[model samples]
Target: MWEVRLAKHLKADLGTDTFDLVQVPTPEPAAGEVLVRTDYLGLSVAYLEMLRADSRLPIPPWEVGQRIGGGAVGTVVRSNSAELAVGDLVRTMAGWCEYSTGPADQYPGLDPDLFPSPVHYLSQGPTAYYGMSEVAKAGAGDVVFVSGAAGGVGSLAGQIATCRGAAKVIGSAGSQAKIDYLVDELGFDAAFDYHDGPVLDHLRELAPEGITVFFDNVGGEQFDAAVEAAAPGARFALCGALATQIGDHEDRFPEPDLTAAAAKGIAVLPFSTYHTPEQVAAWTEHFSTWLSEDRFVFPHTIVEGGLSAAPQALVSLLKGSFKGNVSVRVAS
Candidate 1:
């Protein structure tokens, strides 16, 4: 078996040297435990931020030569629990490894008939569903704006807003191709390339009347623009600070001038997938239904080389080299 370990706390940009691939003897499952043969691994900005020395996540600080934590989808090659059987697909937080062993209680079984693929639960599906439908409460006649709209969660957020009956959906991305993808492929009502000029100007031009809901992913300048452009009684879901993740800053994100947001009576809600089992279940059902009906579009980029490729894959995703959701194929 092979596993990826944090070589050291990252002081600069992430690269292949940040992690080390090492061999380890495979372990057998114990009582109430299962051995998973990893098939796919999910990468996100959160995972990259965790490698930093100043990570604010509740989890203990990362140490040298420790297995990095992440989400992965695999099969139960060996099982000791009554709830699981051999060949069952499951999702786990144990990632960047060829094989993983954990309590059966920890691995949530997935039905192929419903999910079809394990990567569906990785980042885009549940995050988008919960952020847009539950946290943001996007509804009919609402004008919605999603920052980082070309990325995994943002791409899905825009489409989910449309599925929820939002009157107009606006998106901000880094490039013209992404803008075209958002408007032409994902059904965003309007899309803009933030790099073309100041984000505030772009937002005002695209959403002159103001936006009712903002699904924020790339904080900093875009966040300030969204706050400045927020309509009265608007709602905002603070999903991710992608700009901060890649920037050379110790602060989590840039502070937005909230005078306009306060005057407008807007509600800003910070959301996390952790400790949200009820919301997870609800959104999972909703996502499954929408997916079955073909009412949502999910675009993903798959990188090869299994566990050894995860570091570069994550770097590519954070550098905006890959559009859409990113996943590493560990096996067939």
Candidate 2:
């Protein structure tokens, strides 16, 4: 077995020099433990940002030779716990490894029938569910705007808003193809390419009446634009800030001018999965129902070469070079 580990803390650019693919002896299950054979690994922008020396996340800086942690779905090849059996599908935070052995409590069993593709649990399910329903409180007849609308969470957020009965859903993406995807496939009322014009201008053109709800994924100029175009008493869900993830620590994300927000009685709420475990179970059940009913659509960009490709895949995602959820296949 092999695992991908950090070779060194990243600088401005990340590459092979920042990672090491090392062979390791296959791990064995211990008492109350399970040995999982990894099938797929989910990449997250938050985890990528945490790998930097001066990360904005509230965690200690990553050290060299440490196993990169994110999300992984696999099968339990060996289980010493009576509660689990061989061949059980499971999800864990075991990261970029072909196989992992950990306490059974660390690897939760997932229903293959409900989650046929376990990656969806990481991609479109939990985060999108909470951000829209719980944090943003999107409702019928509300006009919603989603920034970074082509990426995994944003894409799902838009679709979820539509399903939640938003009067109109507007999206902003980095490319024309993504804009087309949002409008044509995801049922977005309108979408724009952020590169084509100033973000505020694009928002003004796409949503002249102003949006009642804002789902913010990219927090730079897009955030400013959304604030400028927000309706009276509008709600803003502050999600990930992709701009700050790529920029140096000294580079601050653009703050929305509060004068307009205050005048309009707008509310801005920042949320994260870390503070909302109760929402996870509720949203997961809802997401599974939505998936079965075909009320939700999730698109992912899969990178081949298994664990070896993970580092670069994450780099591409942080650089905004890929669309939708990014995942790596570790085994069949």
TM-score of 2: 0.94
TM-score of each: 0.94, 0.94
lDDT of 1 by residue, 119-162 (tens): 77775667877889889999999999999999988988898899
lDDT at 11, model 1: 73
Which pairs of residues clash in candidate 2, taking residues 3 or more apart in a chain or in different chains? none
Identify the candidate with maximal lDDT: 1
Query: In candidate 1, where is summed lDDT lowest over 10 consecutive residues?
Result: 246-255
The reply for model 2, stretches above 4 Å from the true place, is 252-256, 275-277
Angstrom error at residue 199, model 2: 1.7
Scored by Cα lDDT, where does model 2 land? 0.83
Model 2 CA lDDT for position 276: 45
